[model samples]
Target: MSKVVLITGGSSGIGKAIGDYLSSRNYTVYGTSRNPDTIQNSLFPLLKMDVCNLESIESAISELIEATGKIDVLINNAGVGITGPIEETPTEEMKKAFDTNLYGPINVIKTVLPYMRSQKRGHIINITSIAGYMGLPYRGIYSATKSALEITIEAMRMETLQFGIKMTNVAPGDFATNIAAGRYHAPVLENSPYKEAYSSTLKMMNEHVDHGEDPSKMAKVVHQIIENENPKIHYKVGAPMQKFSIVLKRILPDKVYERMLLKHYGLK
Candidate 1:
């Protein structure tokens, strides 16, 4: 039987890579991007969906279900990032990040759950971040958003096990994706209070992004987990730097970890 996969924020970056990878493997792929014109792939059915909008999410899911009759997998990869100190981050900006990164997935999960429950089988893959596990300066909002998603996804994994729903949280440290340059910085430039601070931190983050793993690598991992008979709850896709960071967080003392993060970002 052919599995049907629905991917959110599939217009670009990691989401787009995942969609292409699964589609290549013969899965019926439905991708939703907020901006439809940006989608060059007509082969995979594309719909316009802003994760912040509940109605749009519902409508897109309903349309997909109507056409396919069932969706076997949902990749909640739509998210946004905000770079600034938490105290300096605007209220609306924080809300925007959370809506896109956290609540957005919640809305999609709600819409997809009913259909999956009826079928008694489904897989939900959330594209979270290493920031979900570790905190760094100037990325407070983004970290918090992913942290919220991490906690929610973990709980969902436990709660939905009995219903035959599998939830996997894929945490990518940094990727050579347009997220930092395109998604986060663009928004910050328009409404930035600490323009210099935001720019410096964003520049540093983008430099890391350029040095990070390729999106295709993560796509391959996603394909593996989906095809696997037994899927793990978490998959970390990142460089040695990311792995080291995770280990440091686990082993280092609290103040030591804080100092390391601060020094690396020149916050110290």
Candidate 2:
């Protein structure tokens, strides 16, 4: 039988691209969205699910198992972006980002683990961000959320290994997607100290997304991870420089790296 794969936030963007590519390759693919009915002409079936809602996630997973008999792989691709100056961003907004981007994926994994454990074999691929490796000026909250998830997986991957289940994080750089439209952005107050820097950084961030690599590239990477018998704990997909930044952070001193980031964001 073809492997059964479940992807959250699959109605569009990277999730949709993965679903489409995997479906064409004969893997049974099911994507999730808050409103599956709203999506039309999706290459694979989409289940109604909200990662932030535990009940919804349980229901969707149960329904998927009932239909497919097994979930061979899961891609936790459901996440929201938040961009704002750390001090100016509302506490509530930051909590909301953590709720969706961090807690949301954890809850889904909690619900799916028992099933995967019973099967004694499965793969979990988390869709994190290249930004997760380090803090970005205006995108601090988003970075933190993904960074936390990356660390969580590092610990959980070991614990779950005994059950023959594999867990890994795939951090991708900016991809051409609708993520910018859905992300939260704290207003740039004209009088705020961060207004000038935040405004310019936000504009630059969007332009990067507008000219980002195709989501299909991310899909291909996901596919390769699924096929690998011993997937690494972390994999990054992006421009050479974007991937190199992670390495730079490792080899360079903290102050030097911070300065480099400041210059890159035009905040120096």
Candidate 3:
């Protein structure tokens, strides 16, 4: 039997791409969205699930289990993007981001682990961001959320390995997706101290997304990871420089790296 795969936030964007690719390859794929009915012409079935809602996650997982009898893989791809100056961003919004990006995925993992454990074999691939490796100006909250998830997986992967379940993170760089459309943006108040700088950085961020690599590339990398016998703890997919930035951070001095980031963001 083909492996049964569950992907959260699969209505569109990267999740949809993955689902489409895997389905074509004969994997049993089901995706989750807040409103599955609204999505038309989906390549795979999408269950109604809000990662921030434990009840909904449980319901969706139960339904999938009932239908497939086993979940061979779980992809925690549901997340939101938040961009603003750390101080200027609303505390409530930041909490919401953490709830969806961090706690949300954790809850989904909690719900699926029992089944995966029972099967004694499964894979959990988290869709993290390359930005998680380093803090970027204006997009700090988004970075923190993904970074925390990355660290959490590092610890959880070790614990879950004993059950014959594998967990890994695939951090993708800017992908050409509708993420920018959904991201929360703190209004650019004319009088706010960060008005000019924040506005410029925000524009640059959107441009990067607009010209980002195809989401299909990310799907291909994920397919490879699922096929691997001994997958690494972390894998990054993006442009050469984007991936290299992570390495630069490791070798460069703290201040030097910070300076480079500042220059890159045109904040210097």
Candidate 4:
């Protein structure tokens, strides 16, 4: 039998692309959405699961395991985006973003570990973002969530090794997906001092996503990672310039890195 793979947020966007690509290559792919009925034309089965809900996650994984006997890989791609000035954004909104982007994956990872452990081998791929590498204007919450998830994945890399479970974070650069349309815009009051800056910055970032790289490119990169006998702990897939930014951040001074981000986002 082909290896079984489970992908969260596979209803669309990068998750959908990966689901399609992997299944076509003969991997027994299973994609999950909050409402499986909405998932159409998928090459593999659609499982109803909301990463934010523990019950939902448990039910879905249990069903997958019952039928497949084991889960060989899991792609934690379910996440939401929240944007606004960090100070103006309500605490509750940021919490919700964290719940979905960070906590949701944690819940899923924990649930799947026992299965992966008993089997003696499994791969857990966390779909992180380039935003995790740097704080972006108006997208501070999104960045924080992804950044936290990456840190957690790093810890799991060491913790899960003895069980033969490998955890890796895939930080994909800007990608054209439905994320822009679904992003929550934090409330910015009219009298807020950051109004003008917030407006311009939000627009700039959203458009960048609108014209981002194709999702299929990232899917191929993910495929390679899955096939590798031993994948690295972290992989950034996207434009050379975006990948270079990570390198620059590591070598450059703090002020220099901030300036580059400002200029790129038209905030300078």
User: What ranges in model 3 sit over 4 Å off?
Assistant: none
TM-score rank order:
3, 2, 4, 1
Model 4 quality (TM-score) = 0.97
**lDDT of all predictions, in order shown?**
0.85, 0.96, 0.96, 0.91
- After superposition, candidate 2 runs with Cα above 4 Å error: none
Clash pairs, model 3 backbone:
none
* Candidate 2 C-alpha lDDT tens digits along 1-268: 9999999999999999999999989999999999999999999999999998999999999999999999999999999999998998999999999999999999999999999999999999999999999999989999999999999999999999999999999999989999999999999998999889999999999999999999999999999999999889999999999999999999999999999999998888
By lDDT, the better pick of 2 and 4 is 2
* Ten-residue region with minimum lDDT total, candidate 2: 259-268
How well is each residue in 1-268 modelled by candidate 1, as lDDT tens digits?
Answer: 6999999988888888888888888999988988887767456888888888888989999999899999999999988877776766678888888999999998899889999999999999999999888777778778889989999998988888898999999999888888875554333555557566666777888899888778999999999999987898888888888867888899999999999987887765
- Alpha-carbon runs more than 4 Å astray in model 1: 185-199
Task: Please give, for residues 1-268, the per-residue lDDT of candidate 3 as tens digits.
Answer: 9999999999899999999999999999999999999999999999999999999999999999999999999999999999999989999999999999999999999999999999999999999999999999999999999999999999999899999999999999999999999989898998999999999999999999999999999999999999999999999999999999999999999999999999998899
lDDT of 3: 0.96
TM-score of 1: 0.92
lDDT of 2 at 99: 90
Models 1 onward score TM values of 0.92, 0.99, 0.99, 0.97
